[model samples]
Target: MLKTSTTNVVPEKKVEAKQRQGFRLNANDKYYASIFLGPSLLVLTLFVFYPMLKTLYISLFLTNTLGNTTVFTGLDNYVKLISSPDFLSSMSVTLLYVVAVTVLTVSVGLLLANLASQKLPGIGIFRTLYSVTMGVSVAVAAIFWLFIFNPSTGFFALMSGWLNLPVVNWLTSPTNAMWAVIITTVWMNLGFTFLILLGAIQSVPSTLYEAADVEGASSRYQFFKITIPMISPTLFFVSTITIIGAFKSFGLIDLITKGGPTNATNMLVYRIYKDAFYSGNYAKSSTEAIILTVIIAFFTLIQFKFLEKKVNY
Candidate 1:
């Protein structure tokens, strides 16, 4: 009985020591994690969170040209924006632009990705060409397209002449300018979206395709069933980012259209810019910024809630 009791006591002490040692190791791990994450958290606080909060605060006040608050306006800026015809027009145009750009960019990107994923001769060169635009700067792209959209001295003009098509004014016309901007945006965004989807497609297991082939599945069947299901997560990610990018687009509108001949391409971001810098209405601009942020957040939440469920992984 004495020997059995001692054995039990020794085992209990050993277990206790182990538990204490594990606790100390966990605490040390947490300390190191905090140290590693501290700089990133600090940077996010300073650059992202602080500016967002500042923008929200400034949106509640009427400010002068220098962004100095002159009066507390509460929600007047938002209310005014909601009722203004110009603001409403801008909102409609922005929504249309976002939809057009997102859809076209994603569709074209998926098509290009599918082509690039094919095992053919010189396929590597084609893939490189497809993704080359990812390295192009937005300013350079806008300028290049600006010349391309020029009525007489541009690529489109030359094409129209050769095809004997109508000499449509690409930039000067209100309807055409919006489409022009949308096309340019779609082209500019295609490379990144294509690259992402291409990688996702390539990452799909060859075994799955072989199985489908052995099962007598057609190419279309394999693509729709095996390929799409496998790459759905990448598709969802690309779509979400593309929507957000379209919403925040300003450079193309600024450089190519400058909000266009009749405010046709005046997206929310450009509207905010005009209100803040061009018109010196800081309150309105800040309000627009907050509204844009909310709009983006709302769409992203919708995608996560509905679209994310469709993703295979």
Candidate 2:
């Protein structure tokens, strides 16, 4: 009996030691994780979170040209913005711009991705060409499109001449200016969206396609039934980012339109910029910034709540 008890005691001691070692290892892992993540956390706190909170706090006050708070305005800025015709117009334009850009970008990207996914001769070249814009900087893209949108000496002008159509003002006309900006934005965003969708498309199991082929599914049928469902998650992800990006679009507008042609392309972001930097109304701009942030966050939440349900894995 004593010998048996000694054997059991030895095993118990070994088990306890192993557990203690595991606990120590886990604790070390957590310590190392915190050490590695500390810098990133600090950076985010300093830059992103801190700025966001500061912007929110600043939005409640009236500020001077130097961005120093001069008076406690409470919700006056918000009230003024809500009642302002320019602000309302900017909001409407922004919503329209966001929807148009997001839709067109995703649609064109999905189409390009599908075309690039085809197994054919010299497909790699086409894929590379399609995704090349991903490397193009916004400034470069804006410059490239600026030349193209030049009313008298642009691509559209040349095309109009050839087609015997009257020269359509690409950037000068209020109606056409918004479309021109939208086109430029769609072109700029297409590459990233295409690459993401292409990766998602290629990652779909070949065996599933084979099974669909065996079942005598038509190409169209298979595309809608198999390919779309398989890549729905990527589509959702792409759409969400595209919407957010479209809402935050400012550089292209600044470079190309400067919210021009009678404030036709005056998106909320550009409005915020104009208010803050150009007009030097920091409080109003901060209010606009907070509103824009809320709009983005709200749309993102809506997408996650409704659209995420449609995502497959």
User: Which consecutive 10 residues in model 1 have the weakest lDDT in total?
Assistant: 1-10
Give the top-scoring candidate (TM-score): 2
Query: Per-residue alpha-carbon lDDT of model 2 for 1-313, expressed as tens digits?
Result: 5345546567788677668878999999999999999999999999999999999989999887899988898998899999999899989998899899999999999999999998999999999999988988779999998888888888879888999999988888988999988998899899999999999999999999899999999988888998899998789889989999999999999998899989999999898889888999889899999998998898799787766576552
Query: How do all models score by TM-score?
Result: 0.83, 0.84
Give Cα-based local distance difference scores for all models. 0.90, 0.90
Clash pairs detected, candidate 1: none
Give residue 148's lDDT in candidate 2 (0 to 100).
85
Model 1 RMSD in Å is 4.8
Cα displacement (angstroms), candidate 1, residue 160, comes to 1.4
C-alpha lDDT of residue 88 in model 1: 98
What is the clash tally of candidate 1?
A: 0
Any idea how many clashes model 2 has? Answer: 0
Residue 144 Cα positional deviation in candidate 2, in Å, after optimal superposition:
1.3
